[model samples]
Target: MVAERKTHPYLSLMNSYLIDSPQPSSISYWYNLGSLLGLCLVIQICSGLFLAMHYCSDITLAFDSVEHIMRDVNYGWLIRYLHATGASFFFVCIYLHIGKAIYYGSYRKPRTLVWVIGVIILIATMATGFLGYCLVYGQMSHWGATVITNLFSAIPWVGNDIVQFIWGGFSVSNPTIHRFFAFHFVLPFILAALVVLHFLALHTHGSSNPLGITGNIDRIAFHPYFSFKDLITVFFLVLIICLFVFFSPNTLGHPNNYIPGNPMVTPASIVPEWYFLPFYAILRSIPNKLGGVVGMFSALLILLFLPLLDRSLYRGLAFKPLSKFFFWLFVFNFILLGNIGHLHVEVPFINLGIYCTIAYFSYFLIIVPTISTLENILFYLGRSNK
Candidate 1:
């Protein structure tokens, strides 16, 4: 009986995938984005630790401490640059990972909570990054904080109070810096928690693979095949980050930020970090203060509703021509908005923003459903041949 059991089917299959699964047939590096995202998180955390060593939490010395690190501490400039550039890279990976989810319908049905948690993590990351930027305490830092927190003033009843409470005064100051530091440290742990929860949820539903296929019988185990795949991805990501850390550490930061915080002087145009450009465009697009706030936040809020909005019977965008068109259109429009956000608000820019913003929403709320129906019609007619 023991000899006969040597080839047990279920155990043998599990062993094949865990000890070894057949090498992936045809796959691209894009499939490694999820693991690349994981690698980015690790980089952010490690660089943040070294920077934190010299990062003074005290209000009086915070700016000077940054200077002292750069001027005196060994390789302090390197540490600072790595942390800053890493932030931008982290956002890049995050957006790609999120896009991967959207294109593959990873947000649908059983994986709804996974996507929802991912949104929450993105929001927290935004908050964490904003706080990190503010901690730099440059003119851009002050102006960025001033503009962003002041948006709360658009609230109907308790707007001013909320803003004051957050600022710890009428404007950004000592309390703001201290509080931001507190939250910056605290929120990442929250993010780490959300990531854990996100992973747990992903396991429950399994990942939405490239082919967008359903069922698990044909699915390979996650251990060996995926583990090695993730390992290779992580290695490549580390190499890229190291090149930046060594060669172009300051490539992503603004030149103005090198200057110390000055309440009297403001930069010609205060732009938030690049990762925030699309929402910044949405914020500036509307003329009204409260309306702009609503529009800005709604852009991100709209993403949370995607699973519900994409009613297409087909899962992957690749197979659905109409859906593919809208997906690319939406992506291009978003990139256009990000570009427009960086420009001075000219008539052409504003007009472009208006058109693209409409196109952006149309891709999600309107075009998706319309084309989904069209897809169903096509499928129905196509089936008649069978």
Candidate 2:
């Protein structure tokens, strides 16, 4: 049996990583998210490939091409909705996966590379999603592409050049659509590569559990136990996606997107897809164009500093009262920021967005380190006293 296993290198690798690999017995449903994310990526790539076969990147025909897919091609509508709704679910899983990492201090020490790679993957995913959003060439799609690309103009002296470069000309035109479509097609393959790196970095240290303890002593194989467990969640995901695809496909999408793109007219509200609202709110919160651009990107890049910012003596928030409390508050603030992004930029909403933006940064920069240091002191004092 050993000789036979050794004869097949790929099967041996599969057995090592999946069938015989050991996982913490205490790991719960949260760990199931990583597998779901892999599933989501496969769904997106497959659905997108089929859509690409019929998609036209020319600005004049892009909108019509989308309509043709919906009306003329059999089951094209199903593929379109699956691609659309699958993006949402992908973000949902990623956000949950990130949240779980934060709560469990998965960025500590040995796993810092894993966390860094994950952040890069998030940025890449957002860019790909934005590019795909612009491919439709609808009212919202056109204006959204215009508005977002224009943000690059906030850069110093060369800002306008950057915007023009992104546009592939002076404006979002035929070249822009072609470029965006090309990029939108290519980025998922990059994301897949990054995800593989993320997996390698993770498996080097193994998974971080809720309790933040080493799982070496209490471990179980990855076969029937977690494999079947992951399948259950995949089934549930399929059911949820089916309901959305069949019953209410457009509920998560903007109605403005159904109309053909008109450079002459702008939508009443030029907003991105729901997944981007929090960062979009951060961008809108700042009054200055340059400052807003900086703030928006800083919100994402700051995530890379987590392993350093968290000066906790131990991993996970399970034992730290203050850290856990502030963590939940941070999550609430993020959701609030998303809501603020959805609203029109007015007096009250503007102020609300600004406050949320401050809180969002405060959570990472101030609240985390402060609470962690204080907790470390209290823990040492308590032990010494005992």
Candidate 3:
């Protein structure tokens, strides 16, 4: 008789999930981004924990404490740089991961929950990032926090109340920083839990491949093959991140964020982090305060409808010529929106922002569905002709 297994429960779990789990052999380097994202999260969390130990959340001390971390604490500069740069890197991986999903039609039936969970993770990440940026207590941080919180005042009845609740006072003050810091510290744990749920849902449907084919014969164990591939990708990503962290640490951050916050004075131009620029452009594109807020949020919420909106029978963009073209157009429009977002709200920039916003929504509300329908019709006609 074969010897009875005597492995620990934890080891058994790891074996089943990591070592024994099967994935599509056709999966390319793009798939490795999932692992890279996880690595980024781990780095952010670890660095954040260390930074939090010495961080002072008070309005008076927050800025000085950050400077203290950089100048006085041993390797605190490195840790701080890692955490700061890691946020940008995290979003980079997530956008690529989401793009890979869209390209492969990973949001289709049976995997809708996985895609929804991923979107939720994205929202959570955005919230956490925004809150963390506020903790810096710089000119931009103070005004940005004030500006964002003030947007809540556009609500009808309880708008002012909600703003007060968020600020924990009349305006962005000591309590504001404290609360934001608390939430910023706690939100990552919540994000970690959501990521676990996302993985569970993804595993239920298995991973979608580049060709959007799902066949057991084409699958292989996640370990040794994909694991090695992921390892190599992670190594390269780490090298890139290290370059940013050590050499060009402040390249992604704003210079205004270095100056201490002064509620009495506002920066000449207040801008958000680069990752937020697309939605920020949408927000500023509108003339009305409430309307701008609504448009900005709608831009993000629109992504949730992707599974239903994309009514195509074909799985990947490779099979849909029209959609492939428009998909790239949508990406180009997004970059344009970001660029316009950074420009002064001048006549030409505002007009450009408006047009880009229209294109952005049209891609989802009109272009995708129409293309999918046309493709389906042509497919049916070709079969009938045959």
Candidate 4:
């Protein structure tokens, strides 16, 4: 029936694949985050493009141009605020989306590819966010870029060359800003394409429900049912973001960023945005420059192995008693690391950050795999006794 409609092939494909797709009826409001993430991506891209229209990527004009947008350009402040705030909210939605997946065991079996693509999207988003932040050419932006890009120098013999390559000269200057701005503009479209692939992969296996069941007994069409649900969720989320944009536009921003970039002086402390703090904490925890760089990248790259590391047969945390406890512990540990990341690199804070970083890695590398194996073994033994 879908094929016989004789409409445009693209429209017909969307109707057959998306509008008429079957989704698990037991899926909770948590599943709405997937759609919310899509909306956030669109908001970022649209607002970013408009801001780019009047943005000057030159080091001298970059900071002042942003000021011009805020003070002179009609509704430019609205667009700029939306783009900035949307980046933070984008992470908010993706983190919740990931948490939902972890709780429901969405990364298992056939959907593993979907999870992998999602992780890639996350990495690309991080890169894009970092580049966008640097385009502001403020105190934090300048020092942050200098410090982060120089981390490449930790790479043995080619370290200096890598840093020079990234700088496009001897230091972070006009060429560096121009290159970062170009990539920042281009990467979002690549991310959008990856998101399309993510949806294709998701549809290949359908969505995982809160119950973690794959049965067809309770399923519904994606049209009016889930569509309206997703719409409502997006609307609510946009309302919250709008509140932040209008009422407290700078709440998520740092005070240091208000000052224009000056190579002559450095801020007392350099910090990335809140969303990057957990990994940043891991980076700063290690004493060695190379080791710290490796640790930071490992923190993110290790997530790729989560589907393999978690050996439990149970599909959801709800069914796994011990795993559930560890899951929330991991969450708390992550927040602790983020808090530590914001503190000065002195005395107790450094020690605390190191400890939290260890806890963070241990959760995935040691605790999850070990408890999962032990729990499965005990389950089988109990069943045999019964």
CA lDDT of each candidate? 0.80, 0.93, 0.91, 0.91
My TM-score estimates for the predictions, one after another, are 0.91, 0.98, 0.97, 0.97
Clashing pairs in 2: none
**Cα lDDT tens digits for candidate 4, 1-386:** 65554377777778856688889988889999988888989999999999999999998999999999999999999999999999999999898888889888998888999999999999999999999999998899999999999999999999999999999999999999999999999999999999999999988878888876774787888888999988899889989998999899999999889899998998999999999999999999999999999999999888899999989877778777788898999898888998888889999999998899899889999998999899999999999999
What is candidate 3's lDDT per residue for 7-66, written digit by digit as tens?
666666667578778888888899888899999999999999999999999899999999
Question: Evaluated with TM-score, which candidate comes out highest?
Answer: 2
TM-score of 1: 0.91
Model 1, residue 182: distance off in Å is 0.4
Candidate 1 — which residues are off by over 4 angstroms? 1-28
Error of 1 at 91 (Å): 0.5
User: Which candidate do you rate higher for TM-score, 2 or 3?
Assistant: 2
lDDT score of residue 297 within candidate 4: 95
How large an RMSD does model 3 have? Answer: 1.6
Model 2 ranges off by over 4 Å: 1-3
**lDDT by residue for model 1 (1-386), tens:** 43333378876644543444433333346768766766667767787877788888676788888898878989888777777877888898888888878887878888899999999888889999999999988778888988899999999999999999999998888999999988987777788888888877766656665666664546564566677877887887778878887887777777787788788887888888899988899888888999999988888888899888877776767688778877888888889988888888888999888888778778878887788888988998999978
